[model samples]
Target chain A: MGKVAREVVEKAGINVDELVKKLVRAAGAEFTTYYYYTILRANAIGFDGEGIKEIIEDMRIEDRNHFEALVPRIYELGGELHRDIKDFCKDAACPDAYLPSNPRDVKALLQVLIEAERCAIRVYADICALTAGKDPRTYELSAAIMNEEIEHEAWCSEFLGEGPSGHFRRGAPGESPYVSRFLVVPKPGV
Target chain B: MERRWVTIADSSELAADGVKGFSVGDKRIVVVRYRGRYYAFDAACPHMAGPLDEGTIVEGRLECPWHHYLYDLESGENYYPKNVYPDDLKHTVAPLRKYPIRETEGKLWVALEDAKA
Candidate 1:
């Protein structure tokens, strides 16, 4: 069982065994999303330049660390890791909602990163809210994850240099003409 | 900065589920009517500059069609699909830039240029 989960169980006056199992499942979901984004970012680097490649690599390492961080908690909670990462990928919530059609396109990659960061921000925030005051240790860990996610989003946005409009324009070529057409309204007096 | 009040639309021009786009000099703005109130924001999305007027308003939040990023109309805060941050931090500083808005004579006016600080 993970040391932190054990502590939470011991301190929260709850059944240690049951809480550990719940945490294991929760961690499994988080690990799945982390793994999926890591793969997506890794693929994105090849289509982009060294700068993006470096960013992707750094993000991958961070995600892996998150997964590793959860393992101890899983074990301490007497839960097992979901062996197949693919299973988790199939139903990921945010970062996994959409994959870039071509990973080599820097713009596409940036768009994906922006979306992923946004998702991470909300998901981590929700997690922090869930654990707040209820489980101090978990709250601390989640809060940390939330901060990094925000940084990742800001980095991606700065790289894109354009907000939502720029993102859609860059990705427009990859999408069906119909989809692109639906994204804009005619400018007044244009 | 020059603040010229460009005529956006007649107050009654926007119906429920309706969004209109306008330009004041080089800036783009969107006027939306949802939940019986008129609201305005930067015409583009903060993430990738998605045209905000082209998106849909539901439950007081705007959902970008490009990636489904939802932003609260009132506070211009992204609601769903937020980024995750590390611990040891007190708060996340990421938020969309909000424009000042006023309703005069039933018409909504939004400052397209940065306000004087």
Candidate 2:
């Protein structure tokens, strides 16, 4: 726990403990979504259009990146992940992105992806809003994360044929254009 | 026996199939408006304490947002895995924890189990 770091936020009239709970939930959602997206991506092989797998994979790794980026901040605020993994996932801010009952249907799969991204957008947006003036570090980090989530939603929605994403592909999968600067240790796996 | 009737949010606030969760003393619970009627249940899923309020409504059953486990609203029965996995004997899934709720004058009240006894 960053004793002085948390004190400043508390003195700013922000409920640091409540904010920490929200942060942990948001991080849990990202990690659990990463898990669910793996299953969704595997089924994307021949189901949807050409870039289906790529879109899912990109969001999957970036979601993990979001988790990684949020951890240091969580500890900084004096919050820690639950000792049990089950508790952590159960308390995630966003719902788990479970594969649809019928995974073969491409449309259902796309809907799952779209909804998950949309939920992520809400999560980060809430964090950004909460910390906007009181905590510069958390606010900036959440805003950066939300920027990526917005694009992810657009990509998934576009894939679902809802509309054009207005985005070409990222330089590579999970490039995390807005968030990579926060990841001191690069490469989600490395 | 004593019962604690706690007033929940106004009826107009919750839409159809909508869920709202709150703390009644030390216990967390969710008040759901389903099919134009109000029903209350323990906010946490029996399996993993998944926020049932975050769950999706499906055919009178609520799907736990964490694992997609389904629970019947009124009966508080495990719906999904029970429907899929037959009595092969490893029935770890439990029924939804339920609370009794009543409505009067545009407001809803829930009877919580862990009230001061």
Per-model DockQ: 0.02, 0.09
Over A1-190, each residue of candidate 1 has an lDDT whose tens digit, in order, gives 4666567556766555544443443454456555655666556644355566555555554544554555555565566655686644433334242344554667766776666666566655655655566666556666665665666677678778754322222222122222122223332353
True interface contacts reproduced, per candidate: 0.00, 0.00
Q: How high is the lDDT of residue A97 in model 1?
A: 27
For candidate 2, report its TM-score: 0.67
Model number with the top DockQ: 2
Model 2 steric clash pairs:
none
Candidate 2 error regions (>4 Å): A47-50, A187-190, B1-117
lDDT of 1 by residue, B1-117 (tens): 766555565677777767777776787777777767767777777765667776666567776544446777777776654432222221332345666666678766776666421
Point out the worst 10-residue segment of candidate 1 chain A by lDDT.
Answer: A172-181
List, residue by residue over A41-98, the lDDT tens digit for candidate 2.
8877563534588988899999999999999999998999989999899788766676
lDDT of each: 0.57, 0.80
